[model samples]
Target: MKEKLVVFSGAGMSAESGINTFRDSNGLWEKYDIYEIATPEAWNKNPELVTDFYNQRRKNILNVKVNQAHLEIAKMENLFEVTVITQNIDNLHERAGSSNVVHLHGNITLAKSSGPNPEKKYYPIKSWRLTKNDLCEDGYRLRPHVVWFGETVPMLMEAQNIIEQADYFLVIGTSLQVYPAAGLVHHAIKAKKKLILDPKVSEMQVPNDFLKIEMTATSGIIEALDLMR
Candidate 1:
């Protein structure tokens, strides 16, 4: 029987592929600050700056390639029922051929109007420097299709369901500092196996079922896959 493997990934998984995360290796937001770029007030006060911040993020996503860890997780899908639950905003996992994926942080490559379901939910973005001039069909401001700090993650319940249904769980690269993503460990209902991969020790507030694998996401994912076989 094929076992269900649920993978939870974060910025570190895509870092090796040249994707800059919201934070740096030292845990600082790169190029922008949380206060100016992620808050609702920021968007309300200066919509252009918020859009511009996400614009650069979109461009940055285009420059990256899927890393070894992303490929390894993709390859594992062939052997087992793999479902990836990633906190990354980039499209690396999709590009790597992983069919079952969940993006918790939102995708950098999509755009949507800021108003209440004004008409469209997904728009393929061509550039990262979005200005006030960019308009949607409803003529509303197009915001980055990201789950900002103050907004609700619409997929959290769905992701929780995925985590609860997993037979095996693998958590990679996340610093586990943020809410919701950090809280997922609380849901592995029937999960009998757990492997957490990170170079630095994680502060995961997990129950006794999880085992931390101390290593980088690249080398650690490879190592975990080898052990699975």
Candidate 2:
């Protein structure tokens, strides 16, 4: 059996592909108020605004390509059973040919029903525009399938289990600042090898045993793969 290799990725993983990180010094959060655009309160207060914000982001993401780092990570499958647990809502990991991926947040390409019903149905949208008119089969407004702030992270347990089984654990681009997601590193503490790829290492808090490759994702991934080989 191939050794299990788990990769935990964040916004930095997709940033090189032209997607913006929300927590960087010059990230999207700098321009937009988090409570106004990325919280459940915002969604309830102005659903149209929330929809518009995600629609624009989806459009931007559609225009971006899967970068080399994604490809390199997928290539790891040749030597290991690779599983990607990403905080990014983009489908770049899947697009890059990764067989298994768990999105810690929600996928941006999908929309879920806002109905009062107990069950929520997700619908795939071909266009970047998700308007208020878009409705699920239950005749309720469709909202972006993203895990906004103040909402529970439904995939946390699954991610934790994946990390705990890792023979080798890798974290790419993420600063390890976000709660719950950041806590995943603790699960992989017993892994044979652990590596973190990020240029801004000074700001991150990670295990001392983790191999810190202080560089951009692309270069860091290349060096990491070489070291693994």
Most accurate candidate by TM-score: 2
**What TM-scores do the predictions have?**
0.92, 0.95
Weakest 10 consecutive residues, lDDT, candidate 2? 114-123
Error of 1 at 33 (Å): 2.0
lDDT of 2 at 201: 76
Residue 111, model 2: lDDT of: 87
lDDT by candidate, in order shown = 0.81, 0.87
* Candidate 1 weakest ten by summed lDDT: 19-28
The runs of at least 3 residues in candidate 2 whose Cα sits more than 4 Å from the true structure, single-residue gaps closed, are 116-119
Point out where model 1 deviates above 4 Å.
22-31, 118-120, 202-206
Best by lDDT: 2
**Which pairs of residues collide in candidate 1?**
55-128
Clashing residue pairs in all predictions, respectively, total 1, 0
lDDT of 2 by residue, 1-229 (tens): 9989999999999988989898887899998888988897898899988888899999999989999999998988999999999999999999999999998888999988776641366678879999877888888788888888887788999999889889898888987888878999889956888888898976788888889899999877889777655
lDDT of 1 by residue, 15-71 (tens): 788775555555438545788888778888888788877777778788778888988
